[model samples]
Every structure is written in C-alpha cells, then in structure tokens.
Target: MASDKSTASLTTASSKAILLLVVFLLTHTLSFSQTTTRTYLVRLRDKVSSPYSVSRPEQFLSQRSIQRRQKQNIAVLERDLPVNPAYVTQLQQAGAKVRFTSRWLNAVLIEATDATMTAVQRLPFVTGLEFNRALSRPVRSGGRLGAETDTKFGQVQTAINYGTSQTQITQLGVDNMHAAGFRGEGILIGVLDSGFMNADEVSFLKPLFDEKRILATYDFVKKETSVYEDDSHGTSCLAAIAATADGQLYGTAFKASFVLLRTEDADSEQQVEEANWLFGAEYADSAGVDVISSSLGYTTFDDPSQNYTYANMDGKTALCTRAAQIASETGMVVVVAAGNEGSNAWRYISAPSDAAGVLCIAAVNQTGQWASFSSIGPAADGRVKPDLAARGQGTIIGNPDGRIASGNGTSFATPLVAGLAAGFWQANSRLTAVQVVEALRRSGTQAGAPDAQLGYGIPNFARPLATEEPMAPFVVFPNPFSDGEPLTIDWQTINANASVDATLADLTGRTVWQYRYQPGKLGTLTVPSLNLSAGFYVMTIVSGDKRRVIKLLKR
Candidate 1:
C-alpha cells in the first residue's frame, strides 16, 4: 500500500499533540470490547423492491455524478442502486456497527463479534459475510495502520513555474497540455491515501483551501471528517498532482478540484483497509470525481490467512480490484501505484493495480530509466501490468511543515499520471473514461510493444491531444479487424468535396497500404482488398490540415 514511516514514531511535539487529540476522539467514539472482534463484509441479497430507482438516480447520486454517467451514455444499472437502508438498520440492531455500504457491490462493511454476526447473518436480507480482519485487542485507531511503504528521497505544473518540479512535469508532456490551457480546470480528482497531514498549511497547497478546490474530506478509518493529522505520505502524493508554487513546485493538475480521502490506515495491515478503499472508491464515484489517484495497495496482511497471492492479482479476486473496475465503469479514471516491490521477494504488481482499465503507474528516474524498486508484473493472468511510467525517484514534493522534500516510490509516480489523465481528459472532454485510458496508453513510448516491466512505458500527455480529435467525424470500424474482410472508413460528417488520404503503416512506421479517395455523397470509403499480414498497425488519415492517428490490430 502507499504508506511510509512509523505513524506512531513522530518526533515533533506538534505531531504528538495532534495524535493525542485523534486518539481521544477515536476512544470516545468507539466502544471497547473484551471479546475478540472481527470485521465482516456483509453481502446483501439484492436491491429488490427498493425505495431507490434508476430513473430517480438524483436521489442516490449527486447531480454531477448523474451528469457524468449521462455524458458517457452509461445506464444506471440495478447494481448502482443503494443497498437497502432497512438491511443496514437491521444489522445495526443485531449489534453490528455498520461502517460503509457499497452500492456497486451491494455490500456493507461491519465490525461485529461472532455472536453478533450470527444474528446479522440470520437477517433475511443478508446473503453472506466474508471475514475481513480480526482484532484480538481493542481497535488500533490512530498512528498509521497498514504497510504500503515508499522510501523518502524526494520530491510540480504548467506555465506555472515548476522550478524543481519541471523535469517531472515535462517528462510526461504535462507542461504542453497545460500550455494548451488544460491544467485540469473543471476536473475533480479524488485522492485516496493514508492522510493529508498539513495539506492546508503547505504554501503550494494553500490554494486548494483558498480557492475552495477541496470539495470534501473523509477519514474512513476513524469515521470522521478530519484527515489532516494522520500521516504525511498522502501530502506528498497530493503534491504530485495539486501543489502550485511558482518556480518552486507545481502539480500537474493544480487547477483541478479535489476531494481528500483517508483510506489506508498506516498503523496496521489488514483486509479491512481494502474495504476502506472500496468505500473511498464508491464515495469518489458518487461525488462525481473525474479521476481517482490511490497510491495504496494490499498484499501480505498482518493475518497470514488474509494475505493475497500472485494468483489473486488476476483482478477478479481482490475487493479493491473489483472496486476499481466498477469505478472505471462509472466514468471515473482510476489510477494506482504499481507497488515498489521490485528487487524484493514479491516483485509483482499489487492488487487494484492489476485491475483492468485502471492505469497502473510504475516508477522511473530523472532520466526516464526504470526505478529498480518499481514493481514489475505480467499480472497473474499474463496481461501487461504497469500500464505507464513516470518520474518518482527524487521527485519534488511539498511537506506538512511548509517545506519541500524528495521521495521515491511508485506512490509519487501514480499521482503524476493521474494528474495527466485529468488534464488530458479536460482537453478532450468527448472521450469516455475507457477512451481516456487508451489514449494515454497509445501515447506511451512503448505502446506498440507493451510488456510487464513498463507496460506501455511513459506516456506523453501532449501526444494524444496533438494527434487527433478522439471523437472526430471519421470512424474506423471492426477495430480488431479480421483478416480478409474489407476495411471500411466512414467519414460521413467530413467535407463532401474534400480529398482524404489514408495510409496504413506497420508499427515501425512503414506504410504498407495507402488509399486516396474523394468521399461519395454518402461519405463512405471502403478498402475492399488489403493483402496485409496480421499485426499491429498505425493508420493516419489526412484531409487538408486536419489529421487523425488511429491504432489498429489485425487478426
């Protein structure tokens, strides 16, 4: 997961004082139980005959969320409906403290004793319960829980002077995107990590408060609104995306709106943190966040039985992976770190990072070389894992004490790519979430030969935006076109009398097929006979000064 340092080992008196207050608040809110307690993920039966309706999505979803779904033409499915409130109340009545409910999964997270869970399972609305975490003693609420470690080595924006941060910003071509006036304005990024620490006090981040860009904050661990006193790890992650200090530092998406969420508990390692991530993801989706940058991951937990193996990285097993998939389906771009486990026993990418459609970021150094510590993977199912790379080593970041620092980890790299996603999407608003993911992949340095190490390699944000209007009038169909079939191009909306030049080139930029045509009244051009071998190819279409680049796979 994306956490660092011993949260309880703070040296500063101010940090200790803050921890005391957090401890006091947690102790007051939580009742101590002498018996062993376990958290269970309660899977609900269904949303049958529920008060909520897909037609009235406004009742359950925020207007912005509704608009995003509508914009993507995504239907509000039954699974999107809220879990029955009656079920939650029943669980509470049965002595289970309901912590969170996931609309997409139709489940609730509750902390309960075995006896209480027995009562909870008997409820007619309950389908099943999965054991998450067991607590032998009283709950460990404060002082960093979970181990998603990233080494401190570190640690910028656009026309906004990115002093020490310039290299990172330009490495991904984010500077060009910003120069094009797409510095993530109007985009909402939800950051899920351990804590924000003194985000409000950081000079570069104060604008988030002054400009009211911080739309919300939540501590899933403590069940509170305050996330400012937990850990400094998240402060650095946020700095990668939102910090703005001219010539000193700048985040890729400094102008974007934000919602800070504390999902990783830095003090303990447990499956419950994954559940917390699910809750945070659900919250981000409901809040209409355009992108989610989570630097956390789960692998081995405190309980050996709860540990995830490489097989579990298949994207279908981990709870957080499922949440990532659902969040992407809901029109939110999900970005996560590709664990810093390289050179370790478990060098594979972590869960949620393995989730398909999510951009799993790997770490690269100042010169764009792969960081030996950045995780590597073929996912467990043999799919390219680390979807992109970004500068992480010695990356510039803002500190809680109102200073700057350098850090190292896939943790920092993850948010830089997330920031790029926001700015790229803002510049190309017509693209769907999936399209956004693909555009970034296509812009990668190794897009044509993506592998486990760096997946598609580092992405150049300007590459995609500079290439074409993703939703242009021209359309190419049967994307993975089967061999021997005609390749059709529909330019129905293009200029009627304009001559179009279409060239299909192999991955190495070798033009294998070329077609020149003036559209018929119908504006359809078909290449009836192409004797090309099966492989990946790039197609460039030029009609006057307007050009479009398309990647194609022939089978």
Candidate 2:
C-alpha cells in the first residue's frame, strides 16, 4: 500500500515539473503582448442530437459528397453530423465569439477574453480549451512563396506544345496522360493556400472564369467571399495546375474545376491559420470536392510557445495534419507540399505533409534531380515521406501580374503532382481516393526503392495507365454506364478462339449478372441494360487461364 502511494506521488510530481518547464520555456521565448482578446480551440464533450440525420444526409452533405461516400463504401456516421446548435449557442451566450466549428473534431474555435473563457469553462458541455493565439493585429511575415527566377530550362514537346512548361510536365509523364484524353475533366480540385492575387484576371486562367470552372472562392482569414485580393502565392500555385497558354505554359489538369480557398495568412505565422485550414478542409469536404491541393505548411509560429518540434511531425500531432488525415478518410485525395526547409536549420517536412493519408510532394529540377531546397523526411514515425517528387526548380508558373515566370520550391512541385492526380483520378474514376494515392506512389520512378529525399521519386503518369490494362485484353466503353445507354464490351487483343466468362457483382460481392460467350465471332458484346442501381460494382472476366477484375461505377 505504501509503495502504491509513493508511485502515485512520484508521477504527480513529475507531471508538475514538466508543466513548470513548459511555463519557463514560454516565458523565455517570444512573449505575448498584453491583449484583451484571445482565440482558443474549445473541445466539446458530446455532439448530442442535431437537426441533421444520418438517414437523410442530404440535409447536411451535398449530393455529390453522398455519392462519393457511396462509391467508396464509406458510411454516413454520426461524426459526419454537425455540432449541436445548443452547445454553440451556449458558448456564444457565455461571451465567447465563435469563429468556426469543425464537425470532424467536434470542436469550436472561439475568441474570448480571459474572464469570458473562465465563464465558458464553467459551461456543463465544455470539456477543455486550448489557447491558439492572442487576437492581435497582424504583422507581415515576409513573402514565403517559392522564389521567382529568371533562368528557364529547355523545352520539349509531344502531342501538346507546353513550351517553357514542357520539361516539368513531361518529367512526370503528365503530357502522355493528357494525350490519352484524361485532362482532369469532371474532377473538382480544392486549393487551400494564402490567396489568389490576380487569378480572377490572369490571362491563362481566364478560361476557367469564362468557362464557369471556378466554382467557389472563400477567404478564411478575413472571413470574406473574395479570395482575389490577398497574397499572390496561391495564384502561382493555381497556375501550376490550371493555367493554359499555348506554347508558353500549360497546367497538367487544365480542364478540371477548382475551388479557391484562402486558408493561410501571408501577414502572420500563427496557429490560428491551422484552424483556418481545418475550416477550409471541412468546407471542401462539404462541397463535394474530389481533391484537396494545399501548398501551405506549418512548423514554427510567430508565438514561439506554439512552435512545433521535430518530435511533433508524427503525422498525428498538428491540427492540420489531423484534418488532412480526416479529409483523406472522407474520400478526398489530400495533396500537400513537403515544404522548402531542406537547407534551413530545421530541415524537414512540415505538418499536413507529415500526414500519412496525404500525398506529400518533394521538389526536383527539370533534369529529374532532387532540388536542394526541397524538404526531406522520414516522418517522425519512420514512414517514408514526400511520397513523390515533381519538377519545382525553375518550373513555369503564372504570376499574379499576368506574366509567365519560373519559380523554385516544393510549392510548385505539389500542384504538378496534384494536377497529375486529378487527371489520373479522371482516368481511374472507379478507384477510391485512397487507391488513387497508392496508384500515384506505385507509378513513381523509384517505386521499387523509395528514399527520404525523393521518397518514391518522380511519378510517371503514363506508366500506371498502360500497365494496369495491358494484360486485360478487353475494354469497356462508356464505363460509368449512363442510363438509357448500352454497355459495350470489346475484346480486340485476345485470341479469337478464347472463351470468355464474365460476371458482374455488386460492391458486397453478390453476383448480379453473368454471361458466357465466345469472342471469335463478333469481338464485341452489348448489353442493352443491366438495370443496376447508382453505385459501384465489380466485373470479373476470365479468358482461359487469365483473369481480370474491373471496377465499374453505374450512374
């Protein structure tokens, strides 16, 4: 009994000592100025019951979002529901001004005075509170975008003349993917960054505006709808994915749609921006976005007390990392920059990039060599980070001032991979978001032997598409078979004498239809109708000893 008491006392003393050490470090580092208002991450105990229901998700989720989840076999759980309104109202009544609420984390970001926070803590529903930062006026953090350069690399062409952007585009075989007609059509990408300065007026990107492809824009920092008035960093990042200028510049997924979100604040390096990112992620998820491409990363904060150490890069420590993981889990491909800290004292990848579910991209030059400034990593937990590399060094980008220019940073590399992912996903529309991430990694140049510097190395977009279907010897046209249209199966490669046996099954593996036929005569088979419901199905075909399984999406 005495020994048990002693152990408990020792543990208590050690925790207190650790808490004191933290206080001392905060006091010695950057001190906070006297401020009346402070922002906090308020954790709630329970979601309780809300106006939304899991049975009727359309009340809270978009129709497209519901379909994505349905196709992925992901359930609509209580966690997907919004926070209890009564809880938020109670917090507001307690003098805490709500900034944003995260359904995934079941928390609220609120700005409140010390006395108001004390009152908020007394609320029965309040579980805990984490101080984010003081609500002080912003001080500009010197522009953090990749440095623009005058030197340009040599260009090469294939089916499309990319001009200055050819090397970067071809390095990843994105041009070949484009040649195959998968130019990211129907894919919706959400870009969360600092801001898009002149994206609204940029010449190469004007087509997106004119075509109504710029679906939405939101500024989280300023809490506004216009994202065209802030930093130019986001504009350049967008150009790396969606810009289109014949012989001068061409983005990898130029035909895809986009949602512009300003989640980063160029004027400050604070933890609140992470909260803003979480908000952006939730918005992207709710908007039925297929991909999230974020060029922003976080490491050190203006308030030193909130700075992260290398130990914090464990994929689960930071809020943004957790949010990125959740976003991936919700069936969105999360792509992030590996950061430009390779030469800095803290030479490592940043949060969100460290997230396991996210595809972190490193930077390589036009020559396919690792860029010196591209952040390196074996995530603190020992997982190979920067799952892929792309041309970022002297890569062509569109300037906010409407000029085509070259820049160097993993920021550019990220969107290059993001665009490729958009196009790749367009080609493999039946694959889940997680499968798309894995397919990209498998298509990497060094996929057989990955490393920290370049991870799996630069991806080859054309390789996977070719390898995935070469042995099948068959093709399905109008794959996501539209209603009132015939589903056609053409076999042009297999021997005419081969016997074909095909079976179609629902996602649950129950066979719905089967057909036995000889391709020797017609070489094609047309089914007028299968009368399938709107969801994903699997079709297995066996020609002699060879077997092939194809995923089919029925709409």
Candidate 3:
C-alpha cells in the first residue's frame, strides 16, 4: 500500500512540472510577438463629444484665424473641432500607442502588435483599421541621422547684398512692390516642411523672434515642440520668405508673420507624413494664417507597395492634395512646390501641387526659362499645374548657420511665390482669397497661353494693381514719394464749376491731410511740402458728387 501511494505522488509531480514548462513557453512566445511593432491607421467613427464648438470658435481657433475666415466670409463648421478625447482614451486603454491624430480625416495613427490591433479593432469606436507600415529602424537617406550640417558658412560674403536673389525678386516685379511700401505687413504666412533647424538662431530671422512674429510651431512627427531642432530643410524654405538681413538676403515677405510647422519625417518616406501634412494644414487654418507654403512633395516611399503612381497625381486622389484643396476653400492661399522630378523617371508634378485652386509653383532660371529640374505637369485631371513660375535654379537661401547659400529645386521657388502673394494681398486687402489667386494667375506674363513647364510664366505684381479705369481724377507723379519731398499732382476737375476737395488717407483710411481747392481746370498742382510716414495710402479727390480714389505709395 505504501509503494502505490509513492508512485501516485511522483506521477502528479511530473504532470505539474510539464504544465509549468508549457506555460513559460507560451508566455515567452507571446512576448516575442508583442515586441515586433507595426504601425496602423485607426479610423475613428466620429468626434461625438469633442470639447470644442464652431459657434465658439475662439475656444479652439486663434483670433487671427477667426479674423481670416471672417474676412473671406468662410463660416466656422463642425469639422474644425478637435477629435473626441474619450475615443483617444479608449484607444490608449486597449494597449495601442497613438502617435498622431488628424481631425480632418477623422483618423488616429497608432502602433501596436497583432493582438493589440485585434483588440483595438474590436472596440466599438474603431470604425476600421488599415495597416500603414512596419515600425522598423528608420531608413534615413545616405544613412545620416539629423539634418545635413552647414559647411557653407565659411563662404560667407562680406557685402550685405541680395546676391543671386536679385533676379528672383526683380523678375516677379516684387522689387517694385517693395519700393511701393508693400512688404507683407499685416500678412500671416504658414510654412510646412520637414524641419527648421537653427531657424530661431539664424541672424536674418532674429527680428521674427524679437517681434514674436513666429505665431506658432508644431512637430507632427515626434509630436512635440522640437520643430526648430529637426532637419534644416524647413529652415532653408523659411529663409526664402522671412529672412530679413539687409543685403546678405531678404526673403520675399520678410515682414510677414509666420507660423512654422514640421510635417515631414526626413528619416523615412511613408504615408503617415501625408497625414501629418493634413494635420498641419488644419492647424494653420485654425490659427488664421492667410497663406500656407509647403515645399514638401510625395511620389515614392521606402515601401515599394506604398509608392504612388502618376495616376495618383490627380488633384482629388492624393490625401495631401485633397487637404490643400480644402485649405484653399477655407480661404487660405495654398502654395506648393511642383517637385524636382523633371530629369527623373517620374517627371511630373506631385500631390497638393496638383490640387486645383492651389498655386502650384514651378522652377525657372534667372532668364525666365524653365529649369531642367523643374517638374512638368498638366495634372492627371487635365488642369494646368504649376500655376506660376519663379527662380529656383541657383536660388539664394540663408543657411541655418547665418551664411547665404544657393540651392537648386522647385522648393525655393514655392516660397518666393508665396511671399509675393502675401505682398500682393497686403497691397489689396479688399480682394477675396479666390480673387487673389485669380489675379495672380491673370497677372502672369503668359496668361493667354500657359504651358506645363512654366505655367503662366512669372507673375508681375504691378499687373494686378493696374486697373482699366484710371485710379482717380488726378495723377500723382513720383507716386512713391519720399517723406520730406513735395508731391506733384496733375488734376482735372470733373465739374467745371465745382470746387475740388482733396484728402490723403493712410491704408487704414484715416485722414492724414485735407485740402480744399477752388474750381480747378486741367493743370498741374504742386504741394510745396508734405510730411507722411512710409506706407501705402489712398488719395481721394472729390469734385462735387464725382469722387475718385487713387492708391498712393509713400517712401
């Protein structure tokens, strides 16, 4: 009886040991599987209980953003609200790590294991889940980690001159606009790019920080405030618009307010970056930016299967293109690079640039000829792409280290055009966003016959300000007059017997000077002395009921 009891005990101990071993193996295998992470796009059902409202846009949007929409008569809609916090919390609770959230697409980017993904999908709030890409080691181009280091600082020039940038600004007639006292004052521009390393440290951009003109900044890749710490691509692009060193380099809209956004992941090419761009655009819209300048483009990715074909260049196909169109519809002028694929196998314009209503900028040389590297296009939908052209080849840019360097790519041209647009908008604040785009297109040198290579050719800022009817009943010689100099006016009274009532007002319509003249004939009237600050102004001449308002530029 004792031997039989001992045998039973030994058998029970062996069984328990086997059970313990099996459990250990199973747990190890589960942990190994969980360690391999994959990225996915989590599509949420709705933002049902969002902590924002369209009626009270001030709660979510900046005062400038609300003002921009109001200026263009764009209404605040429910789509502008933030995503529901509850949905995000529920997602986090399911063991999935959420990276970025895009309210425009109503989606969230998450990283998780297969089991976690299954759990997330089973949740009621998750409408669908699409595999994005595997989260492996970043495949950086040239195997470099951070932004390319600046080696051109040693080649700095001593003179404070525009250097190679003269042709670019002068070619677009922006020089004339600058002389006319319109240098993007009161205009807000948003820059969306990969990174802006040393942007805050650059000498040319010092005024932006000092004046607090940099309204906002966000990094969609790391989901942090490290926009200025990333790649230098964005810094180069921003220099084309906001750099304000007197001679070394002057960006197109140097005086414009800026909202910098880092939307690209320079480490890898993926579809998530497109979502990042959409999020950036939505943020810019809510911040009340007037123009969005993006030098980033998409075509191929690190994953072969995720590569976009030429057909995807259609305005409505790419995710970024759709977002850009939505941005334009929301009353902000969208400017994008036409891509630098002219000599490559994929020689075509990229997304967002193909989107209609957005000003797609192509690259050109100083002589106004198409750059060999400039992307060619008639968008897949047959719309004329690259609505305008600007200097891109050998374009001058302010390096992050305070040196001026020349870069070649449509990337440089996009900001030049964006700054020009801002200056034009500043000159004519009464024009609607759509009207501003149309005026720009119409003012192009080749407006009558536009081609894919050069679009409407280079835009001339003076063309848009030229009207069919005379600006006023009188003409002012040397219209952009120096502050201490006398102004010569050639006037002709509309009513022979009526006296002439003349008033000079600033751009804000505040009367700065008033003069009443007796019944005047067709003759030149010289004002001996006039004191006015440098800016744009309006001179109104009233002859009885016939009043004429003419635009005036003060130096």
365-412: candidate 1 lDDT, tens digit per residue: 999999988889888988888999998787887777777667788888
- Measured on C-alpha atoms, candidate 1 has an lDDT of 0.82
Collision pairs in model 3 = 65-288, 160-247, 161-247
Q: TM-scores of all models?
A: 0.77, 0.79, 0.78
TM-score of 3: 0.78
Q: Note the Cα lDDT for every prediction shown.
A: 0.82, 0.84, 0.80
Give the poorly placed runs of model 3, Cα more than 4 Å off.
1-33, 49-51, 130-138, 141-161, 464-555
List pairs with backbone clashes in candidate 2: none
* Residue 105 accuracy (lDDT) in model 2: 85
* Alpha carbon deviation, residue 288, candidate 1 (Å): 0.6
lDDT of 2: 0.84
Candidate 3 local accuracy as lDDT? 0.80
Q: Pairing residues by index, what is the TM-score of model 1?
A: 0.77
Best by lDDT: 2
Clashes of 3: 3
The better candidate by lDDT, 1 or 3, is 1
